[model samples]
Target: MFKLRGRLEKHGEIFEIGQSVKSPILAVLPSLATKFYSNVPTPYEIVDAQEDRKTYQGTIDNVNRQVSEGKQGRIFAVVHVAGKQFKITEGDVFVIEGYWPPDAGDRISLDKVLLVGASDFTLIGRPLVQKGLVRVEATVIEKTLSHTKTHFRKKRRKQYMRINFYRIPQTMLRVNRIEIVGEVNHPPDVTGLETRIF
Candidate 1:
């Protein structure tokens, strides 16, 4: 004789099966199937949400304190300017090639910051950092033309030759300072230009 032993559920109540059968069965049937299955989390996989939040808050506080005290050390930033990106620090001079409209002695603030770092922490942007977070100030020190380059082409059999020389305009920029002007994780309020003229 064979007996089937398993648990059955009906009307939110569980009832045991094969209890009254006196004959011994060669094999026992497993419990009823479940709709879904999930693995139990191990010790290493379990995370305490409160503790994680506390640690994150502590790190933000530390960075804020460092910024407040001005002890964060020399900061550096990667800024996008005039279709190019430049990794700049305070007092660094760099050149931009092309026709840029900014004239010499013009002070400009680079708004398209990609990354900013200090001695302790770094902030990276997805496409760009939050506006007003990192301020990179620079001045147009000089505007001049790059060294001339010759473009020559010749066809020996056809007796055709062409020679051209040209120079590209360049703008020299001196980074005045790079600083964190806004609190970490805090973004400025959004405003629209509804009432202003172009």
Candidate 2:
């Protein structure tokens, strides 16, 4: 009778304890997880894409009367592509988004240049792409070594060696000319003054 009483008491105590103990996961855990994910920003949002288009409108300085000289050579321009900064070298090959050439792989000359600006002067043309100022054409010059990987195994131990190299294809460009189809407002008239100072 005593054993039976003890067993009954122990069973009752276990039931009470079980009811008092809380679950491993609290009710609020799910909410906290949801909140954490909701607050994080996606990788695509790191750079604001809308702002890149606005950069098109800006002052262009045509240094050394680059517009009038008609001397054709490689020119450097800072352009943004897909939320990234790109230095466009003259005679480089690049295709426009909407415009397509008859030859798929053939070099398409940029006839409608938007603006021409150098260190000295800036010439703004119509919305049309400048015929003479578009990117020049160059073929892939050479492909250099890009990367290398090596692995060695000795005495049950593994060793890894990795080398990385990046190469960009270069093109040869012969500048024909640069011409602005539209007009320039408040045209800069100063010519013979000190080219060094404003």
TM-score, predicted candidate 1 vs. hidden true structure: 0.72
Provide the lowest-lDDT 10-residue window in model 1: 26-35
Residues 60-176, candidate 1: write the lDDT tens digits. 899888998999999999989889899999999999999999999999989899999898998899988877778889999999999999999999999899999999999999999
State how far residue 10 of model 2 sits from its true place (Å).
79
For candidate 2, the lDDT comes to 0.38
lDDT of 1 at 10: 48
For TM-score, the strongest prediction is 1
Can you give the TM-score per candidate against the true fold? 0.72, 0.26
> How well is each residue in 91-141 modelled by candidate 2, as lDDT tens digits?
454432322223333333433344555455554445533333345333333
Residue 104 CA displacement from its true place in model 2, Å: 15
Best by lDDT: 1
The TM-score, computed over Cα atoms with residue i paired to residue i, of candidate 2 is 0.26
| Number of clashes found in candidate 2 | 14
